[model samples]
Target chain A: MRKPPYPTVLKPYGQALLDLAKEREEIVCLSGDLTRQCEIDLFRDALPERFINVGMAEANMMGIAGAMARQGLIPFVHTFGVFATRRPFDQIVNAIAYPSLPVRIVGFMPGVSSPGGPSHQAIEDVAIMRALPNMTVIDVADAVEIRKVVPQIVDLPGPVYLRLKRGEIPVIFDDDHEFFLDRAQVLESGEDVAVIANGMMLSSALLAAEALRGAGISVAVVNAPVVKPFDTRTVEAVARGVRAVVTAENHTIVGGLGTAVAETLAEAGLGRPLRRVGLKDTFAEGAKTAPHLFKKYGLSTQDIIDAAWNALGRTDSAPTAAPTPAETGEYAPV
Target chain B: MPSSTTTSEVSISRFADTIRLRAVMMVAPQGFGYLGQALSSAEIFAGLYTHAYRPGHDRLVCSPGHYIIGAYAAGVEIGLLPEEALLTYGQDDSDLEAIGTETSPAVDLTCGSLSQGLSGGVGLSLADRIKGEAGRRVFVLASDGELEEGQTWEAAMFAAHQGLGALTVLLDANDSQVDGPVSEITTVEPIAGKWEAFGWHAVDVDGHDPEQLVRALDETGSDPRPSIIIARTSTRQGLACLPEDADGHFIKLPPDLAEAAVQELESRLA
Candidate 1:
């Protein structure tokens, strides 16, 4: 299959973050020995004084970030999503969250962005960060989105967690596309079904919408980057008009976009039959291959098509079958 | 809002006495608490809160938050917090929460988890430094037990590498932790060496000696390196009548034994 046309005018999020660092001297960057891995090398090269490498210690990096925040510097702590969530959760809660410190936690290689096996894949980062109070969670859909969102996060009052995709991120939005921390963008509008997606799954959802349209099933694709203060109004509005909701994400189905959409629908009394197309309540196991795992966990375009059809009540004619637990049971919940 | 006070008269012996008296008072209300750790850390807390630290409405992040009573007593004595609040220690509906409160004016960072305060302190200190505010120091009191947390070392390494001269870490090496002695659980020996290796200017001192602590703090004044004061102290430093084997982390004194401990403290104070 031919890849979708890449956004030519898109700028990398890492470059945007480095630009912010130049403008704001107080905006310090900290990494846990994953500078290149997390794409913080630009910040390191440009603002050497402001960049700190804590050397593979995520917990300590978190604590130091909190301490730096306390001292009046805006510290942007970087690490893999898994390490940031699991290693220093206590530090994040107590030092950063409880104190309401202006510590920007940048989790690199989120979801299946890393090919370094399950250990590096941050499949459940959203679930862990979302549970904490006074936390702002943002999932950047592409480099353009991340570049645009980096400056806005600086002005935010409390703790901010930015989940970034490593390597070259595909652009899903144009420069003219309007974005807000609390608003979800309607990329493609339709009435038959609504697909709420974020991160890597967003592009897939858009592709699925196009495929569904070719099959005469109209679908609305909403890009929900900010997951904490989720665009509940947009969600409710979208849910009100749709026959069924298909929430997709690169994270686990439990706490990521799927659960967020499910809860929003359930709360608004707009409970439609919902299908969450993401990693099941499980971790990414087996070899460190992305394509194999993406196909296995039903996160690819085919999975979204099947899920969209299932939500549209056309499961009998859906092109793909629902993945049984036995076929993909090796990926247990982390 | 500033009061003129001097550390000249407050010697190590006097500070140790105050710690013992305060620990006794804390146990007077609750028959059993972390008296061993509190008493052991008395001289160090007294030195920092009274002399070395420039206390104001500014922050002090206490990680190893179990030693809260010791901090409270020091705050009370130094007029940073209300003395009456100490009476309500561990009571319901008290502003002086058994655990620290973020909303409370006295408490800076609400700490219960060990090895988390340095991060908060770093945040506060970084903010102050960026604003070009001088003389404001972020003091973090960490327990020996908290050394087990990799984050502490992370903060240590960051602070030193960043040359956060305004940040001072006081590691209370009272030799006791929950469950058993620290050595039995995780040997954090050569702690000063570890800090030195992390690029910090580490200094070891007799924790019961306030004079030594003050001198150590003075020496680190405006130094480019992140300063760490490793205070070697005993869990049971000042009080008698408490059993020698009593775990300072959590003291369990029967009613009669509690009364006797209080009486012993009272006699010492008298």
Candidate 2:
């Protein structure tokens, strides 16, 4: 993982959207009274005519987005993660996903990222979006992925659910990083343990891998940003090459990335030892900080290391805690 | 109504009868379907398709899936769909589903789910406006029962707030839903005042009266606000074949009843 002093970009999603909208006249942005929160203010300021503040009506906003897509207008509907996926699920299914419309559902504050408790935290968004047919699900890791993802998914040929982090985004990947909609990147490959992670958990998995490498336990680290069109060959290859596998995500273990990998492995009949590191079938409480929720919800670097240790059946080899990276800025993946 | 998706060569009193007759023909084969919905919404379909709908220009957003029987009938009358297609309604592997779906032909977007059509109407209209084609129109055929869905009001508030003048909602105010009469379930009465309160040009009209429907629908963009014609209708508007005790929401046409219903609609058409 990149150390602190990692340059941060504020509202990377908003900037990317604004930049994209400038090039594509058919791109329209809609906010459900979450204009600045979801970070489309830049687009609104630059291209006011293309932006719509659709009030707090999430369901109506989804229907409107679907209808807009039918007219060849790419509508990016943004809101807090919870309202974006759950509250308007039926609308998403009926108007957007059902007909395979090309509306981009941009949801901010994924999982325990929000301090607004269960109401604001989109703990189950990935699962909800993953379950829908014709929905391309993505959870971008950093500024690079966000910028690349916004433009790439525009021509996805169907609806896409994009899970993003608000505020200053960490620059995990380099400026020239390439992102594919159906590929998972193997950050570091090792033989003993494979850690397939995405979103906020990628950094933690990297830190865990670093500590495991130091402990003489080889670990493989993979970043799976796209969850639905899950790169089965990559996931299977990574799992097949490792003694045990660990799936980490900033979401509930059920029906999310973990479940996707689990389904893939089981279908492929890869009887690899698996451990999932995420919210363990539980709702997160309101906390002052996301790291605190991560630590409390068993989603920290230490937890990933412990899960790896547990998966490897190394009960005697007590897992060591990797130095928790100093949250150098206002936002840092713990 | 250049909703761009209607495929309507767009109806009259005779057109209204044509729609009712087609609805019977579609449902008769199934022996049961949302035939009552088709009956109640027949004239609203006829009035809009005859007076407003323009094929390859106008779009029709059918929110209530059950009303497709009437819509398909209107489609057949407009020559967009084959009349023979009605016989295949509810048959195996038919696109003519008992309830409208995305595959349902003729309409722009067909949702069996309630109250979603209005939002779609707003979206279609809003999309046109965003694309600098604000004059392109959409006629949304919704059910009164869907007013119970919160999304209906949400769409209402948005459409009116946006001044979607080209969007016309022909609400079939048939006082019946699945549970019995809509008034008995959740009264969406004072429906006009309700829409007006939401900033719409509300007009309550007789669903069966073609003249009233034409006038009400014509006022859609007359004053630059979204227009709604709440056509008050009944499940038995054009069908006298059903027994007095028949369900007024979804009708079951067991062979004899189906035969009788078809004969009655044919007689009216003749």
Candidate 3:
């Protein structure tokens, strides 16, 4: 994993997809009038015949992708997180999941990452997607995972709901770090508090783990990219060694990464004092910058720190707020 | 391209009767099912399976789950679906759901979710076009009530936008829904004009007439624009022995009524 003030990569997802599509003929990219925003513009320009601009009709777009998959083409459908999941959920369930097709629903700008407010924020995407039987819900942490994820989930048996961050993505993990659909990246192995995270909040968890270590509290950090089909054995092993657990996500705590961790631990006969750091079951407002919403929604590095402190029964003042991790040219990771 | 397994000897009229007979048998065992769908769409399905659909080449998506019963019957009338499978219709541990699910055979994809099938058909058409498979066509069997759904118009707009010439919609305009007359529930009339406005080649026809249905089916994939055959039908189109109080939407079949209905359907061959 990379340190703070990490380098950022622009359009990593779009570029990786384009490169993969060149070799994989079955990779068909779909856009819902947000091609540039979701970063599938590269795919459109590179492979005109394979890329489809399905206008603003998300429901039809989902069905179309499902049908395309039915004919042996792996469709990577793109749109904002909300439009991709909430708008066309039934179509995804009926046309894709129920049929167990190999269509990948690429939802960008998950949670409060979208500056478009509640209407555009997909705070509940993971929860809804995780409920579906055959769906593989994923939330990658950085550009490294983004690049590695595209090639991995191409033919993953059934439909996949991939939650991605739009625009310039941060480089959290270095080139040597590997991403797997069925494994969690154990970034640190300290035993006091276990911090589990996915999507944009993963950077926050990593940063908070650093600060917690400075405060002399040992913390175990795990990056849970694939929320559904969660790496339960890894999580159980990590959580079992820790006194308390903290789950941070760029989504609501209700049914997202936090809930996944909670359910996994509870079912395994392991009960730890768990604190969830996320949206707290509330809608977010429109913002000028993504960090404004992230900070206001209690999804910053400090939030993870506080949650870990609370879980560990450490009542002292939360660690000092750290500098905003990414600069203007980069996308917000927390 | 035709299904290699197709037995083309069966006449369209006989095929339609076969659909009706098989559907009645499937629903009668349960004492209740979407019998109205089979009655209304038997002719429409019979015409398509015999004239337009090529099992291995062409794609047929049944959009309305309830409408699938009729298509299932048509599948049995031919040798495509196993003969004895109809006996387990609507029973537990049976894949033959009363309202066809994605697991059901014969149709490609699902009809379980109303108003989504047309969009799927458009996608299939686009895939065939992308693969340069010019001979492959896609057909969607839909119900009139689905016109009320916003997704239907959304799919319609996408199909037209793509200029999916190989796509066709066999719209069953039975004008009856579970909530009574569809006209009372929603104004779906001027259906042809709506399709035309959506940039499709719309053809209105007597759904039960074999000749009209066959002609409409023949016009599919003839141009850059998609086509929709608005088939006007009645839920009680063919049977002569239904009692005066029989509800066409969902008939409750008593032993006596089922026997009478079966005898009437069988005697029609005479």
Candidate 4:
């Protein structure tokens, strides 16, 4: 059993941002004592004057960023995804969102990616950030998308809540692949199943599609990185002729990719059999590795394959033996 | 627009009295507004706008946004806002809200929530330092009750750590809050000592006295830390005619009593 290549996206993100900071003095960095953990140390080391370590106070970091924005300086804040969305929600709404400041809040360890358990996992970040009026919610699918999106986010006018992949992550997209805001990337197209996914789950979706092809079940993998201001147009188009639909994410099914896709389909009157693969209503327990958490939370490639079969109403026998982990009584719908 | 009245202490005192009268007129008709908090803050607004601050350039953040009625009254007194706009206090499509928010250009920083404005003031002052924008100071006026919010302490520490000498804070210690006396609400006493321990240049002053407030705003020692003035005040300081039992935190002034209070303020100005 060999592991796939997992390249660190944080290093390249830091390198790309450091280059941007050299050209733009208004680009200031803020962190809540996770400078090294989130790989903002690259900006800190290269340009100490522009980097601000606001200790562990996430709310104050948001306030400081809002104030900096008020004074015509663009501030980028980094922290864990949970703290980024939950800890400073009121401040982010009042100071950042209501005023529509250009503060880039980069939240790493989105959803079940953090093995630090429920406290560190941000399964509801996308749901909460999308609820904010002026907030642009972006979930990066891979290392290549992260590199391309950083500059695009800098050019964006209002506040953004960016879901990030820290440490080593697999490269799923090509180096020259195009990136657009409020747009979903159509990775592979098929007629049998429209498999929409975002964040780290997109890679798993691609794997599941590849594996399903061998079983004569074609699955369309649509990488939906931008959750808020969701690409419903592209989603409907991709899902138009597909026999069934499935959505995948590392976040909870409540307000993540699954809900967005369901809403799009429901509104379009395209009532196809739909299945969602992600964390249930239950909190994740601490695990040693992402693969372990993925298995426990029912986000592995096998879960996606099972969901695809279930969506197609083929429950007699499947590629994998175990039932859709969602049906095993581990998680209740939220 | 420059104030038509003289900038002397006596003139500012009379102007502050007129502002208090205007605040009562704006809020009293609404049947419910922050009349007491607004009256208590009139002198502080007068002291800053007339003596300590340059409104067009220097920034003033109202952390305790209920006090905005008083700020708007002072703006009208100083000819910053048209006098006829006073009737539009809580009406729809008006700049004025029942609670001050991001609706108006009068407030440099919009904060209806407590304890958040100081952080904005810190950012504005820090920006001035980083951008080399000299002669620009940021003043934040907050309630003593807002000190209970953790973000206030965080902003306090950051201001001291960054050496934000250009930032000044007026902690309106009106003792009263919506939940009753702040002492009973959360025990935010020993407020000046806390600021001093946080490495700020702190001072205690009679909040109602314009002389003391102006002096605190103007004086800064060799210390490069920020400044906080603990202003001990009564929530209903200007309306001596009102009963002591009348709750000032948020009140609907009786029509007759509201008129009588305004008459007393008008007589003092006369």
Candidate 5:
């Protein structure tokens, strides 16, 4: 695979967290045996007094984080996204989110970040967290943004669910870029079409934009890292000017960025031709390679390009026909 | 003995009675609650708040959150909450939420899922230890039914291995659960022995006796290991109007029997 236009930057979000732990004594970290994968080893080493390993118990880790928060300690509970979401969603909802505690939930190995196959991929985490009340859902696009956003989330006085990628993710944002918790950032501006993306899909969206640019279709890329409390204003404004809107996410199409953008547009009465490029309604089979899995789930760069073209009502073939409700089902309403 | 000491002891007993009365009032609104558990556990709750527990400092998590009436009663007795809050028990727009305890200044954790409280309690104890606040204790109240949860065992192992001596678990071995008797569902017989095997300093005692409960709590300090007090209690100790076999898990007193049960409790108190 060819590298994108951005330089390969080794941005360490977890190391920055370790540095923050030096001054903030109230910051306690908990891991469920994912220390190496989560890159929180430095924090564990530096602050042995505050770091706790709850074995392989994710549910207990959540409960521990909640109780620690109650005692005026800020706990960052780290684990894989699947374990954090499916294994302990009830604890997250009742113990952490319901009480609005200052517990930072770091869901590592999000969206194919783990090569250990389907069981490790966290494609549905956003859907689970966004449905709950008082939960701030965030998907960091790259390491630079993750480091910038981590400290800000600690300061915010509520439960924060931060999705982090494992290992060295290519840096998409510049160091000088000012990132906010709830605000959307427009990386590139154009009037032809708007491409909304988050997480690893942000890089794909940017790549798809370049591919579209070569083919005479101007596209704008907006990085919406925060899904819950989404930037509806930005979505509405951009949707009005663009010919069609395409949403890209490394999550399932059901309740991730695609659903969030569609909901916003529908609510604002600006519904238009929109295409969502994400995982289909299915679990990862755990047999295929990561690249094959991405291709099969329609999360590749080419998939976004095809989706953008489809949204613009463009057909490469000779046959042109009217869309039918019977054929399209729910897509007809959109 | 000095007269002042005698007066203080009487006041403490009165405080325990106030907790029982507040719990009884809260249950009256719903027509019923875990009244047996509340009544049996009132004295222990009173002692914790009045003597053992340092309010606004230490942490206490109720594992079997269904026994919210007892916790509310303890809060009311200690003036942490008002007695009028009991009027909203099981009512709409009431802070007294059914099943799950609502988040309030008086409540430490919103515990409804069984076995979560012990894990949460371990977290608090670890936090206190990290802060070097060794005097602060983390108390968790677990019901007999809660032992069925695997997470409780995980927390038990965790607390014991960490040597969290400041963490204390009080088990209300009422021998009752939702389906039927705890033994029928899953026998937790020899609970004290099981806890001892798990590396805790286990103490089995009559849950209803306030003096025994206090003594057991005092002994916990002497042991370096985390403590578990297996409180032997009855499912329906105070309200004898109901049949002994009547399941106290979710008591549904008919309208006609409600007045009789209340009258019986009043006569017992008198």
Candidate 6:
């Protein structure tokens, strides 16, 4: 309800990248004419010689990154999520991921974060990049996590597709929060229900968990940042003990965090009743703000709360939180 | 015809002829390969390996993936690959597959996907420039069909924009694609002009002439801008001695016709 304290989450990412570049000369920054949008201008400004602006050509940027990686320089490429993943999928898969090159493809405006709508949203990046043999996929929850995760992947080998939130994001984690690659962060622990979320969706999940706790529901929130190597061990342990499960994300429910959790639980034979909250097999139309789009697509904290209650078999019977906008009928169903 | 051919030029021409013959012979057993494309690109490879590309120092990238036979034959000539391994091409458990990738023993980078090698070459050249490996040039052997890909133009733009003088692209303008002639499928004509417009020092040469190709490739590097040698060639340049059926873009070389083609190349080399 209040204004987010952070003006832009991507500044930390840009600062982190610049810091990394300062630490290692092998670190080179590249952009697809999104230096300002992706907040890579800081890196560009600091290390002008190492920064390469490849213009609007995503595929060429990827190919050049692959070539740069081959030359033993670590190239961190930034673009719109869709352009970074879908437009240049072949170049990433063949030239980068297939060869296990260490080209970090940082995709901003992931999922429904892009107000530019379907063309710009990278809803399927996680699914596609997850399918790659040697790709490491990570969706950071907040700016604090971004500052920690961005620098860690520099030393790691092989290709990495990092989904990021760009401008004016809510701050979640504290300053001392540390990040580990391929590890899940358990934000809150409870016995009755487990809510697994990633990227900006974790903020909503935290809010939903707070409201659920006020209702004496005792909900657990797992920040599943490393989406690809899905942290099956942690997810399995959480799903095994929890009474019910709810997975939320800003991406399609088909292959994002929801699917990752569902697959992990199903493979582990946990048989816990699960609810997936995300874009249901469709595209997000252009909207004025991300929060309105979230409320429209049933991704707001209220949606997560409702899904949690439904997963617990309570339905709409017992609810103490404020009313959701989905009940208001202002956002017509697509 | 341009100048008096030296003994080394004659030897490099023989190497190219052997590459063409080996490509024909290797594809004959399988009955399927990019024989036409390989034949036209042989002299480019020979000119590069013999004149420009240093075995351990410089890097050569094959962007036209199906030209694996030419790469393997040239690899044999340069002692990077064994001649016995040529027989195992397109066969099971062989390092030399029908398409060349960075995984292939002799290949420095992968290229099954088109329009990627020039960018890769640019990366290598850029790395060379940064690492102070000044004389270590990066050579890319691209195809006419690959120019149809938008990434090729993007790479062309990037190479010139970076002023990659150590990068030289030998475009095998073999005039045909798998579908049809390159013009009919997609008009990449004004090809030299396109490269020049992209800030490359574009040079047009006869692709099949080892001497001219050697000269063109030799002269392509050391310019301030990225250089491109558009080697104008036929799709099936060397197999003209065979029946017309042997000249398709992707041909299944019948055993007897394949033999005849080899003999023609052998006699030419002799």
Q: Each prediction's Cα RMSD?
A: 5.8, 3.6, 3.3, 4.9, 6.4, 3.6
Task: Give interface RMSD for all predictions.
Answer: 2.7, 0.6, 0.8, 1.0, 1.0, 1.4
Better of 1 and 4 by DockQ: 4
The digit string of per-residue lDDT tens for model 6 on A185-246 reads: 77778999999998878767777887899898988889899987779998888777789999
Clashing pairs in 3: none
Give the lowest summed-lDDT range of ten residues in model 5 chain B: B1-10
| Stretches of model 5 off by over 4 angstroms after superposition | A1-11, A286-288, A317-334, B1-21, B104-107, B254-256
Using DockQ as the yardstick, the better of models 3 and 6 is 3
lDDT of 3 at A80: 89
DockQ of 5: 0.71
lDDT of 5 at B55: 73
Listed in order, the DockQ scores are 0.53, 0.78, 0.80, 0.72, 0.71, 0.66
- lDDT scores for all predictions? 0.77, 0.86, 0.87, 0.82, 0.78, 0.82
Give one digit per residue, the lDDT tens place, for model 4 in B107-164.
Answer: 6886887788988898888777667787777889998888889999999998899888
Across all candidates, the chain A TM-score values are 0.92, 0.97, 0.97, 0.92, 0.91, 0.92
Docking class of 5: medium
TM-score of chain B of each: 0.90, 0.93, 0.93, 0.94, 0.88, 0.94
Task: Compute the lDDT of residue A26 as modeled in candidate 6.
Answer: 90
Q: Tens-digit lDDT track for model 3 on A141-180?
A: 8899999999999979899999998877788777988888
Model 6 Cα lDDT, one tens digit per residue, B185-259 = 888889988999999999999888877887787687768788999898775777766556554578877777777
Q: How accurate locally is residue B75 in candidate 4, as Cα lDDT from 0 to 100?
A: 81
Worst 10 residues of 3 chain A by lDDT: A325-334
Give the C-alpha miss distance for residue A91 in model 5, angstroms: 0.9
Candidate 3's DockQ is 0.80
- TM-score per candidate: 0.88, 0.96, 0.96, 0.94, 0.91, 0.94
How does residue A17 of candidate 6 score in lDDT? 88
